[model samples]
Target: MKKPFIFIISVLGVILESCYYDNEVYLYGNGSGAVCDTATVTYSATIAPIMASNCNSCHTASSGNGVITSDYNNLKTIVNNGKLLKSVNWTAGAIQMPLGGQKLPTCTLAKINKWVDNGALNN
Candidate 1:
């Protein structure tokens, strides 16, 4: 009886231990190990792609609802007015961006903030 009880407990312990969860890379993604290079955030490359993928779908040349995201000069207006970051970051009093989608990824946000902080250059 004692031997049987010990065996069952050992088996349960092994099963429970295998169920442990501490996978940061799996939960948070490989971004934990990968580097996010914000040092070269640029409009033509970084910002354009982000906006094209997330914003331009709705905020285009003629259908932006007064926000023309397809044009760089018009986009600069929003950047200078502080609406870009506020909307993307979901700040109070600012419209939440991407309309109904989940917020942008952390690395993407960092690159955006870096660009904006650097005066939101047209580069």
Candidate 2:
């Protein structure tokens, strides 16, 4: 009885140890461990790609809910209106974006915020 109990406890411990979740920052490091690069963020290279991957699927010209985001001009409209940042940040009074999906990662948000703060230029 003692041996069986000890074996079960050992097995449970192993299982629990193996179930550890990987830290997001560590897994998605920005060159260094657990770092996020907010500097050097560009609209074409950084912001546009993030939008294309995450937003454009639903917010495209024809199918969009009156909120086109497939191109820079349309995207700039939302950014200028403060909807893009508010929605993506999941702030109150703004609809959470990528509906039914998890919020954007912290690093991605930081990059976007940096861009927005820098006048949200077409660069």
Candidate 3:
């Protein structure tokens, strides 16, 4: 009887623990219950790194994807035309970015929007 009770309790505890919800912004503290700073979103400082990590892999100049993100000029073309925001934001009729990967974090998306709203500067 003791063994059976202990086993049941352990299984219940495991099930409850597994049901608990957690995510990066919640645990690491950024998008939720923490600051998502978009105050100084610059090309070199902020936007460039984002593109390099998320976009440049497949959109490189040599990749012939017709969207070269490795350089500022090429990137600017899509930025100006609104493709960047649409794709990343996963807005209707726009192709989702990272092409089958998960959408960017909320904080990251906010930073991109901030950069774009600030004239998508080359700085």
Error of 3 at 3 (Å): 77
Residue 27 shift from truth in candidate 3, angstroms = 18
User: Quick one: RMSD of model 2?
Assistant: 10.9
What's model 3's TM-score? 0.73
Better of 1 and 3 by lDDT: 3
What TM-score does prediction 1 earn?
Answer: 0.72
Q: Could you tell me the lDDT of residue 62 within candidate 1?
A: 72
| Candidate 2 TM-score over all chains jointly | 0.72
Q: Which stretches of candidate 3 lie over 4 Å from their true place?
A: 1-29
Candidate 1: lDDT of 11? 99
lDDT per residue (tens digit) for residues 53-101 in model 2: 9989999988899998789899889998989989999999889998889
Candidate order (TM-score): 3, 2, 1
TM-score per candidate: 0.72, 0.72, 0.73
